[model samples]
Target: MAYQPPVRDHLFLLRDVLEIDRYSNLPAFADASMDVVEQIITEAAKFTGEVLAPLNSVGDKHGCTWNPDFTVTPPPGFKEAYKQLCEGGWTGLGSDPAYGGQGLPHVVNLSFSEMSSSANMAFSMYPGLAHGAYSAIHTGGTDEQKQTYLPKMVTGEWTGTMNLTEPQCGTDLGMLRTKAVPQADGSYRITGQKIWISAGEHDMSDNIVHLVLARIEGAPAGVKGISLFIVPKFFPNADGSVGARNEGVKCVGLEEKMGIHGNATCVMQYEDAVGYLIGEENSGLKLMFVMMNEARLGVGLQGVAQGEAAYQAARDFAKDRLQGRSLTGPKNPDGPADPIIVHPDVRRMLLDSRAVIEGGRAFLFWTALHGDLMHQHPDEAVRQKAGDYMGLLTPVLKGYLTDKGFKACVDGMQVHGGSGFTEHFPASQYLRDCRIALIYEGTNGIQALDLVGRKLASSGGRAVMSWFAEIDAFVEANSADEKLKPFIEGLAGAKAQQQDATMWLMQNGLANPDNAGAASTDYMHLFGLTGLAYMWALMAKVSLAKIAAGDTDPFYENKLVVGRYYLERVLPETAAHLAKLKTGSATMMALPAEAF
Candidate 1:
């Protein structure tokens, strides 16, 4: 089966479970009635299913080609598909109306992102990077810079990229050798080589926006000296039209990636390129963090989106491909063999994937709602709490979802049996494509460290404290609901261990910092488990209420079953994470170099 948009599930989560209409008083929600949201999602489904899904295999087969004239050609039909995407206004669904976007609530626009990502992972990255660049300038760019770049970017007329990586730097920006020289016209001349730049040289737009980070000549060493600059591929004319080529930048080469071949991962060279400063001097890192944080959330979504794609393919195969007879009896008595879906093992993989994908969607949307509230809520307290949740949960969403989501894709391949090993099956493509989510936007290991090292202590520990209080309130409010008691108990049990782990880290981590380092991954994952359990609980509550009101839709009943499966089969792994994290750094750090 082709990757159809999971529109039914998205609607159930947004309109029913989240009940976004309850926030109709907020600016973003004022126009986001379920009717409007449904219309947008329906159209997006049609666009992605028809325009993008057919290109996945074509992209994987042909990949992107680096041309002689310093331009890279995308896979077959990508240029035309991108034109349709731009014209449809799908790129700016969540952006501000002031900059030519649809001005919908982010959670609503997120449905399109998830759908497009599942339909075409490789093609999705081109616009994905542009959104990150748009957000950076959106929040930090000066008014003129916004007017110069935002309109075209929101309309997908021009694409964008973040230039931070170098031959020497991936995560460590301190040692970067890129330099910016101040010039007579107040424009700095940027000179550097940036590697692994996605959408760096694709022939899909009028001009490319390069958000470069460089150290000014004679500035202080390390990250403190860094600054952000706007260096477009072509200068804008007096009427905001594309002008002369800057003639100082070029795509030297492209990386042949393991997957996502549809996106041009270019190695860029800058030789005295005209650059405009953004924000305050020596504060680029601070500004870039806004873009990185948002990109990290998108990366997490990509993981689950790939899982959804793989799971759908596997689900279709299991139903149609006949296999050995059912051990108990012949469900297909007239046929010589039963469908593999009739077997318990096949059910395990399919159900496990379903549970992860659905629960993951609930978690993503739940977090994204807070992203909307963070900026638009009326009360300062609500805004602060929302902001804190966004910060605290970003890494959890990135690290945990990618870990499990990739595994789900692998399980999808296993479900396809030998066919999955070959390139003909989409399962192979899904698994390969899913692998990069673990490494980019900072590896999963770095995400864990950021969680334990940075976020937990931010704002005098307000973020984590706020998260705990909210989860506690949820559990207390629903403890007496007999039908939801198991979910509540599951959430409570996992959360209690998380609280315990937090207490241990507080007592032990500061004194022996390695304790935190060693326990970081498990703690982050435990946080993931607890967070998903809470999402499942919220979904269960909504489904139960629907069933109570005499809504006989089997969707709600299936929701309850999946939620139960999550709580019973999947959630118990938290115990191991908690146990392993509490072990600290002693045995973990004892091994000497070359011991292996």
Candidate 2:
């Protein structure tokens, strides 16, 4: 079966629900009307569906191979696909127009990004990391850095990487050993061994710009001592052209990963490599997070893309492949078996995948909206509130979405029966790719801790309060829509339960911090479900409004149905989390070390 881009649904979201036309009227997006956005998405879809998607299995089968010469080649056709991406200008969609970008909306760019990842996740990670590097530099880099680096990066003439993790430190940066020594000039000499550097050392582009995190000599310990540096693979000349190769940076080896093998996950070593400071000293971690947050959401979208692709594959396969008879009745009397989709259990799996994937897409879009509001909204109070909402929801979007998205992929694979687990199918590959989303860009555990500890009390809880207000306002506005009544009511109940749970943790965390730590994981997931439920209701409301307006698309009807499914099945998990949160941390800590 061939892949068809869901451009209709995407356009519906943009033109109808989001009414991006209003935003397009603004000066920044003046050239990005619905017609232009539609055209762009259509072209991007063609590139993804026709060019890159065919190479997915090939990339998996023939992972990148690293030669002893310290050079790595991506799987067959991967480089050409990358060239297609660059030539098409898909890499610079949301970049600053002052340089080489189209200066498009982030959500619009994110739509294209989702398509690229769905087509080929392993290949997508290369430019994806580059986008993060570009964002960090574009946001904090000096004027010289911007003028010299932005054009090349935005034009896809060069690529970039984020270098933070090391052999000794993964999450706990307080124990990091990477060193940065200040030179007589303004530059610094950095020496560190960074492991699992995605797009770290690849032959995809002319140069690799690494945003490295290292400590200055004699700086205070912990994350505070960290500083960000711009370390390029090949030094850039004053004219912004490539220059002599910088010594000290080398790709010693690549990790043997379960999936995304087309991209090199290299062990990078830097010995006194020349680097320029990105931001203020002793604030490297702070600067690194600007990139990390973007990357985290990108990872979350990766999970959604994998699940969507897997679901599409499985659904098509089930319909085409004849299997067991339906339980209620046999419709295909002349055939050997009925379509597997007829079975209740099979439907359950597909529905679960459908519900989670669609809901996750909407959730990601809403999060992206907040991101745009944070950056584009002029009012300081509005920006602050938007930032708070983003902070409160980022963990949920990153952690819970990926967690369920992994399972959704697994279920999608399971829909293929025995073939799902075999190398002959892509389901297993989807599972492999989806699994890492949970672990990388800070583990779900770390994201959960951040949500409970830092974001919950930030700005005296103003952020969370504003989030509750949005949900409350939505419920109040849609109260009369009977189709949405149950979802609105059920989601409201879940939100109330979450507020109580959060209050419990906040009050008790002050005395026994373990309360927050122990409940953090569950609490984060619960909050994510509630947030997603709220998004689903919003989607359902918009979908219903479209239907009432005589919108002929069946996709809108399906949106409402899936929103109901989320309400009835997925959203109810809040009760479970509430139960766990109410149980407190005594039982969790009851098991001592000797008990094991």
Candidate 3:
């Protein structure tokens, strides 16, 4: 099945749910009128559905072949599709205006990215990495670096890569051994090997700029000593054009991964490569965090996009495929069989996927709004609060959304029966592609740790309390909304469980550190589901109001139905997570060390 962009629902979320109409009046967003936003969404939907998605399955099946010359060629049409994406200016949608960017809102850029990634994730990573690199440079690079590099990157004339992982250390950056030596000409000589570098080597653009993390000689050990360097495939001269080729950057080989085969994940080798410091020496990790935070949100969106796309495919299939008779006895009297969608069990799967897809969509964009608020809010306190909330939610976005999104994809594929498992259908590829989301950009396990060990105690618990207070305010404001009663009640129950879990973790920390670690994953997931439920309820309230007012779109009514399904079924999973959290470290760590 070809990809279809959820442009209508995306516009509804922005215009109605989040109310970006207010942004239209803001000085920073004055250029983004509602009409333009709608136009962008419409065009984006066409590009993704028509151009990128067709290559998805072929990319996965053919993968990329590495030649003996060490050059990489992507699956057929990927190059042409990438050129189309770059030419369309989708690559630099949210970059800085001074650097030739359109200076669009991050939320708008995120919406476009969702459609692109949903259509073809592997194909999208090339520009995705470029966006991260542009963000890093804009946030931390010197003015000269910005002037020299940003425009080219923003124009999609060049692409970018973030090289942090080595064979020995993927998540644990403290174990990184890449080194940088101060060169006589105000540059540094970087030497290291990075593994699993996505978009590390591709011919889709003229140059590939690498933002690498390496330690300076005599620097302190661990993450603090790490410094960021801009190492390009070919260094540019003072005239703003490509110069001599850098000698050390090499693609030793590529990772043979299960999905996203069109993206070349290379094992990069850098031997005394000339590098320019991005920020002050030994401040690389801190600067890199900015990029990591952005990418984590992107990864979260990837999860939901795939989930929603898979759901669409499944729903279409279920509505057409004829199967066993309905339990209500011959609902389709004209034929020997009934549409599989007639079964309650099939509806259960379909509804479950829809619930997560819709609910997850709201939560994902809500989180992106926090990203917007983090930067755009003028008040210091407001920006700080938004940033803190963002920090607190980042782990949840990475861990919970991706986890649930992958499950939704699986459920969506299941709704297709035996056909879902076969190579002829794209469901298997969707499942494979979505699976990597759980492992990269800090594994769900690592995200869980960040939530329990770091974020829960952020600002001495002020962040958590403030966030809960906001939810409480929302619940209080809508308590009288008759249609939202069930959702509001579910939120309250989940909130209580979350509070209890938090308190237990705090109390148990002194006596048993392992307790927090053991309960962390479940606790994080529980928080995400509850949080999504609250957002979904908020969306449903608005949607229900529209329906009551005789809103015309079938989309609005679908939102209401899906919102109810989420409240009824998906929200109940929090109970299982809560049960696990209540168990603490006991069941998780009961076995002896020698048991294995």
Which number leads on lDDT?
Answer: 1
- Kindly list the per-residue Cα lDDT of model 2 for residues 441-527, writing each as its tens digit: 999999999999999899888888887888888888888878889888988998898888888987888788888898899899888
| Model 1 pairs whose backbones collide | none
Cα lDDT of model 3 by residue, 1-596, tens digit: 57789888899888889887786645446777778889988999999989998888889998887767667888899899888887898877777777778878888888999999999999988899888998899999999999989999998888998999998998989999999999889999999999999998877788889999999999999998999999999888798788888988888898999888989999899999999999898999988887898889889888988888888888889888999999989778898799998999989987887787778778878878777777887778878888888999889988988998898889988988899999888888889999999988999999999999999997898888887888788889888977788878888877887887888889985478898898899899888988888888878888888988988878877787788788777888888987777777877688998995
Candidate 1 lDDT, tens digit per residue, 44-120? 99999999999989998999999899999999899999999998988889888999987899899788999999999
Clash statistics: count for each candidate: 0, 2, 0
lDDT of 3: 0.86
lDDT of each: 0.92, 0.86, 0.86
Q: For model 3, give the 10-residue run with minimal summed lDDT.
A: 23-32
Off by over 4 Å in 3: none
